[model samples]
Structure formats: C-alpha cells, structure tokens
Target: MSKILVTGANGQLGQCIKELSVSLDPDNTYLFKSSKDLDITNYQQVLAAFTLENFDFCINCAAYTNVDKAESDTQNAVNVNSTGAQNLATACNQTNTTLLHISTDFVFDGTKNSPYIETDKTAALSVYGNTKNVGETEIIKKAPKSYIIRTSWLYSEYGHNFMKTMIRFGSEKDSLSVINDQTGTPTYAKDLAEVLIKIIQNKPIPYGIYHYSNEGTATWFDFAKAIFEITKSTIQLHPIATEAYPLPAKRPKYSVLNSSKIKTALQLEIPAWRDSLKKAINALP
Candidate 1:
C-alpha cells in the first residue's frame, strides 16, 4: 500500500480526499497535515518531514486562495504559494517521492476565448495568479516526478466557497447580483478528489501538468442560477458585468480548461458542471 502525505488537510480539497479515502482507497495509508502541523514555506521543516517518512507520494494542497487579499498581501502569498511550493518540490525530489500539486486557472490572463490547454502561455493578471504560476514553475524545475493539476471554480460541501456563499446570500437576501462576463466551469471538489485518487491508483501515471474541471462553460451568473435552482431558492439573481463590481484583483474573463488531455491520459469521463453541482448540493449538510 502506498503511503501518501496530504498537505493542507483542513482545506476543501484535502478534506474531500480525506472523506473519499474511507471507501475509495482503503488499503493505502494517509497522513493529513494542516498548515499549523506543517508549513511548506519552511525548507528545513519540509525536508525533515520527508526525511522522517518514506512517503510514496506528496499531495501538496496548501495554498493562499484569497485572490483580492493577495494583491495587498503579496509577501504572504509568495511565501505560501511560491516559496512553499519550492520547498515541497525540493524536498519531494530529495526523498524520491512523487508530487501532486493543485493549481488554479487564474494562471491565464483570460485573453483566449478557447479552452486553455496545458501548453498555453500563462500571463497572470493578478498577484495570486502570478504566485501560483511561479509555484507551478518551481515544481516543474525541482520535481521530475510531479503532476501539476490546474483546476477552476472549485467548490464543494466543505469550506467557504462560491456555492456556500450563494446559499447563505439567497437565504438572507431577496436579490443578488453576479458577474456574467467572466466565464469558466464549476468543478466539484469531490469530483476532483476522485480523479486524484484514481490517478494514484492507476499505475504508470503520467508525470506533468494537466487540466481537470467539470464539463461545459459557465459565467458566474449561470453558476449562481444553477445553485439557486438546485437548492430550490427563489432569490432573484441579476446578471451584471465585471465593471459593475470592482475588486482589488482582476479575474480572467474566460478560463475554461480543456480537460481532454487528462481524460485521455487517465481514460476517464468527467461529469458536466450542473450534474456535479447537483451531487454536491445534495451532499451538503
């Protein structure tokens, strides 16, 4: 059985992995570490953990996800997303452990209308994106046996996410405004969790960057509408332009990921955004 070390255990993706571990891959051993338990930004700390445990794989889920806050809190974002990734990659390299790092679609500037392939040029528009892009680069440079999976619009039953926010707002208010200009896919973290586990189970896994998200394209308005529909809420949702609402960080106008490469590599079929959304909503407590 492979011994896996999953960083950022308290995060949504990490929690999803932990939830799935019970029935998905019961034989494997898993060690879940939160940011407090282990900080990836510290090279010595990371190396010490690697040295202590003979980990078969290190799933690095630790990341500073606040997009707007990242603009002002640049150093913290860099320390966690960039330097933290560098430390993890270096330690994973030294320990001969395969690394699976999670990344974002924000790496793209949202200029391209078409779905972004793994080979597309990353022109990050915000500090968060730039740092994450740097993290991907560091992983590639340091770890040979690594898989960087870039996903978009990630949400689930756990944690603070778009879905949960919509649910709360719909309950509290009668009307809500959402951005229609920005387009992407809503990926259920549970679906992503399954894919990650499947990749681990699938022998002779391909080691490189890959894109995984639910099928179909959607704007934020479309996503919110779907959420209200699934939850049977009558909240009047208005579709607004990106310019209508101003934020510290600039978002990609379009960041739809072409998941064909990952599908072909893993021989897997991904679910549609709405289908997975229904599942996620139903799974919510």
Candidate 2:
C-alpha cells in the first residue's frame, strides 16, 4: 500500500479526492494538507513533511486560480504558483517521491484554431498563465519523475466555479448573457480525481506533461445553456461575444485540448462534457 500526500486538500479537486478515498482507495494511506496546514511556499515545511512521512506520491492541487486578481496581485501569484511548485518539486526529489502537479489551459495564448497537443509551444497571455507555466517549468527541472497534468474549465459540486455561478444567476434573473467566443471543455473535478487515482494504481506510468479534459468542446454560452437545461430552469440565455463583457484578464478565444495522449497511454475512456456536467449537477446537494 502506497502512502500518498495530497496538498490543497480543501480545494474542489482535493475534496473530490477525499470523497473518493473512502470507498475507492481503501488499500492506500492518504494525508490531505490544506494551505493553512502546510504552505507549499515554505521549503522547510515541505521538506519536513516529506522527511516525516516517506510518501510514495505527492499530488499537488494547490494553485492561485483567480485569473483577474492575478493581474494585479502578481507577487502572491508567483509566490504560490511558481515558487511553491519549486519547493514541492525540490522536496519530492529529495525524498524520491513522485510528484503530480496540476496546471491550466491558460498556459497557451489561444491563437491556434486546432486542439493543443502536449508539445505545443506555450505563450501565456495573462499573469496567472505565465506563473503556472513557470511552475510547470520548475517541476520539470527539479524532479525527473514528475507528471504535469494541464486541465481546463474545471468544476464540481464542491467549490466556486462557472456551473455554480450560472445556477445562482439563473435562479435570480430571468435572462443571462454568456460568452460564446471562448471555446473549451468543462471537466468534472470528480472525473479528474478518478483519473489521478487510476494513475496511482497503475504504477510506473510515463512521466511528463499531459492534457485531460472532458471529451467534447463547448463555449461558455453552450455550457451555461446545458446547465440550465439539466437543472430544469427557464432562464433565457443569450450568447454574446467575449468583447461584449469586458474583464481585467484576456481569455483564449479557443483553448480546447487534445487528451488523446493520456487516453492512449492509460487505455482509458473519458466522458463527454455534457454527460459529466449532468453527473456533477446530480451530485450537488
């Protein structure tokens, strides 16, 4: 039985992992640590944790995810996303523990019309994206046995996300406008959790950068409409271009990822975005 360490345990993906551990992971021992409990930026804290418990794997879910706020708060973003990742990678390397780091689709500038492959040259547009990109680079340099998984449009029953935000707005308003220009797939945190567990179970898997999102693509407008439809809501939805709603950060017009590499490597089938959205909505209490 492998002893696993999960950072950012209170976040959406981390909570999904915690929930799955009850029934799906009875054989393995897991240690879940929130940022308050173990700050990844603190190298001493990260090193001590690894020294205290000889962990076989360390799954890093901690990140500074606010896209707009990151534009102004660049230092904190760098502290957490870049420096924190470096600390974890260093500690993991010292302890000989395999590291699995989470990344974002924002790493790309969204200029490509086709789906992004693992080898695509990353040119981040926003500060958040740049920081995450640096974090990925740090892990690759620090740890040889590491996996960096880049996911997009992550949502679930647990945390603040696009689905929950749309549901709240739909209930309060009779009509809503969503961005139709931005294209990407909505990934259920639970599905990602399951994939991570599968990687752990299938030891000695290939170590490198990978992309994993739901099977199909959809714009924000499309996703919002599907959510209201699944929840049986009557809110009128309008598809607007990204220019209609101005925000601090610039989003990729099209950031769809090709998840064929991970799928082929693991011999796993991924669920469609719409299907996973239904499951997430059903799971919500």
Candidate 3:
C-alpha cells in the first residue's frame, strides 16, 4: 500500500485531511506529524522524515498563519514559511516525491476589483504575506512538479476560525463588529482536503499554481451573520470599514480568487458554499 505524509496533523486543515482520508481509504496508512514529530525548520529532521517514510508524496499543511503576530515576528514566520518550505521542497526533489504545498490569497495586495487570476502579480501586504510568498517561490523553483494551491478564509470544526469565533461570540453577546470592507471566498478545509487527495492520486502534470475556494464571496460581517443564522443566534453585526478595523498587519480588502482555471483543468465540480458550510458547521461537536 502507498502512503501520504501530512505535516501540521493537528491543525484544522490537517484534521480535515485525516477525516477525508478515513472516508477515501478505510485502511490507508497516513504518516501524520505535528511540529513535534518533525519540524520542517530543521533540514536534517525533514530529510530523516523523508528517508524514514519514503512515502510517494507529501502535503504540507503547517504554516505561520498569525497575520498580525507575523508582522512583529517576521523572523519566526520566515524561518517556518520560507526556510521550512525550502527544506520540504529540497527533500521532495531529492526523494523523488511530489509535494502539495498550501498557500493563501494574501499573496496578492487585494487591490483588484475582480477575482484574482493564478498568474496575477503578487504584492504582499504584510509580513505573513511576504513570508508565504517567499515560501511559494522557493517551492516552485525547487520542486517544479509540485502543486501550489492558493486558498482563502479557511475554517473548520476543530480550529479557532472566523466561523467558530463568531458562533462563540454571537451566542454570548448581542452585538459585534466585523470588517465588511474585506471581501473573500470562504474555503472549507474538508473541501480542500478532498481536492488534495484527488490531485495526489491522479498525479497529472497539470502541476502548477492554482486557486481554490468556495463558489461565492462575502465579507467578514456577511460570514458572521451566516454563522449566527445557522446556529440560531441573534447577534447584531456592526459593519465596520477596514480603516476602523485597524490591525498590526494590513489585510487585503478584496482577495476573491479565480478558481475557474483549476476547475476546468482538473475537471473538478466544486461544492456550493452554503452546502460545504453546513457540513463543516454540523461536524463541530
């Protein structure tokens, strides 16, 4: 039997991979590792993991996703995002294994009004974005055959995401403020997990950059409202502009991605946003 390795096995996306794997292969062997078992920042450890597993492929789910924190802790973010990605890319190249690297919409400055194409010029807005972009360049240059899928607004049952946060705050309070100026497509980890598995199994050399998210766009306020409605909570949402919702790191106001190329090229039928949302919400608890 073949094996697939996944890093960040404890994160939201990693958990989704585990759940999706169980359904895809009842007895499939998964070499899931957290930062403890193997830290990508350490080259020798990554090499050792590659040698020990000798798996056919790897899906890198680990990332420094703390946007604001990353602004101050740029070194930490670069260490993991850039250097670590370099380690993984180099290891994959040497081991003759494929890699599926996860990316974010933050690679763009979010200035465009229309959905961002995969080939759009990348202009990072924050330290987190810059580091992630560096990681992407390293991986692409080292492992040309790897698949780099850029997603946005990720959420799941296990992690503290926007949806979960809103649900918790909404149930406990009567009102809240969300940045309505920031618009993006909400991506469910479960859906991305499925897509990853398919790409790995098929191994078609359509290998390049791709954008994937749910089929629709919404602001943080809209997303929060959706969560409240689903959970049956009456949390009044105050629409706030991005200026009013300042943070240490600047976020893209509009980062809606164009996933049509991936869909057509991969022959994928993406699930509707609401349908995926309901499944993710129901999976909680």
Candidate 4:
C-alpha cells in the first residue's frame, strides 16, 4: 500500500480530498496536514516530516490564493507559493516521493483568444500569478518526479469560493453586477481531487504540467447567473465589464484552459461546468 501525504488539508481542494479519501483505494494510507501541522516554507521542518513518513506521494494543495491581497502582501505570497513549493520539492526529492503540485491559470496574461495549452508562453499579470508561476518553476527544477496541474476558477462546498459568495449575495442583495469580460471555466475541487488521486493510483502517466478544469467556458456574470438559477433565487444579476467593478489584482481577460491533454492522457471524461455547479449546489447545506 502506498502512503500518501496531502498538504493544505484545510483548504478547499484538500478538504475535498479528505472527504473522498474513504472511497478511494483502501490499500493506500493517507495523511492530511494543514499549515499548523506542516509549514511548507520551513525546509528543515518539511524535511523532518517527509523523513518520518516515507511518503510515496505528496499532493500539495497549499497556496496563497487571494489575488488582491498578494499585491500588498508580496512577501507572504512568495514565502508560501515560491519558497514553500521549493521546500516541498527539495523534501520530496530527498525522500524519493513523487510530488503532485497544484497551480493556477493566472500564469498566463490571458491575451490569447483561444483556450490555453500546457506549452503556452506564460506572462503573469498579478503578484499571486507571478508567485505561483515561480512555484511551478521551482518544483520543475527541484523534483525529478513531479506533476504540476494548473487549474482555473476552483470552487467547492468546503471553503470561501465564488459559488458560495454568489449564493450569499444573491440572498442578501436585491441585484448584483458581475464581470462579463473575464472568461474561464469553473473547476469543482471534488472533481479535481478525484483526478489527483487517480493520477497517484494509476501511475506511469507523463509527469509534468497539465491543465484541468470543468468543460465549457463562462464569464463571472454567467457563473453568478447560473448560481442564482440553480438555487431558484430571483436576484437581479447584471453583466458589467471589468472596468465597472475594479479589483486590486488584475484578472485574466480570458483564462480558459485547453484540457484536451489531460483528458487524452488519463482517459478521463471531465464534467461540464454547469453540471458540476449544479452538483455542488445540491451538495451545499
């Protein structure tokens, strides 16, 4: 039985993995660790933890996800995303553990009109994006057996996310204005967790960068509208350009990822964004 270690256990994707762990391969032993349990930025601590467990695989879900906060809090972002990733990669290499690191779609500047492939040139526009890009680079350089999966617009039942925020606002506010210009696919953390586990269980797949998100593209406005529709809320939803509702961090204009590579490699059928959204909404309390 392969022993697995999961970082950022309290986060959305990690929580989803926790919830689904029981249903996964019973032979595999799973260990979930939060930032309190294991600080990935501290190299010695990370090395000690890996030494103790002798983990076969480490799924890194920990990240500084706040786009706007990253602008002002640049140091913390670098510490967690870049340095932390470097620590994990180093530890994983020493322990001979395969690392499965999560990344973001923000690595790209979103200038391309078509869906982004794995080999596309990256030019991150925000501090969060830049740090995540650095993390990916560090992992590639440090770990020989590593997989960097770049996902977009991740949401789940466990944490603070776009879906939950929209649901709350739909109930509280009479009307809402969401960004229509920015387009990307919303990824369900549960689906992503399943895929991550699948990659671990079904070995011998190409290990490098891969894009994974729910099928189909939608703007933030479309996503909010769909949330209200699924929840049977009558809140007035307005579509506005990014200029009307400015954010501290500049978002990608179009960050839709082309997931054809992962699908072909894994022989997996990814669910549509709307379908997964409905499932997520139904699962919500």
The sequence of per-residue lDDT tens digits that candidate 1 reaches over residues 92-204 is 99999999999999999999999999999999999999999999999999999999999999999999899999999989999999999999999999999999998888976
Local distance difference test scores for all models: 0.96, 0.95, 0.89, 0.94
Candidate 2 segments exceeding 4 Å error: none
| Model 3 per-residue lDDT tens digits across residues 96-119 | 888899999999999999999999
Report the candidate with higher TM-score, 1 versus 3. Answer: 1
Winner by lDDT between candidate 3 and candidate 1: 1
Error at 121, model 3, angstroms:
0.5
Best to worst by lDDT, what's the order? 1, 2, 4, 3
lDDT of 4 by residue, 180-203 (tens): 999999999999999998998885
Model 1 CA lDDT for position 54: 100
- The C-alpha TM-scores of every prediction are 0.99, 0.99, 0.97, 0.99
Clashing pairs in 3: none
Q: How many residue pairs clash in each candidate?
A: 0, 0, 0, 0
Looking at candidate 4, the ten consecutive residues that score lowest on lDDT are 19-28
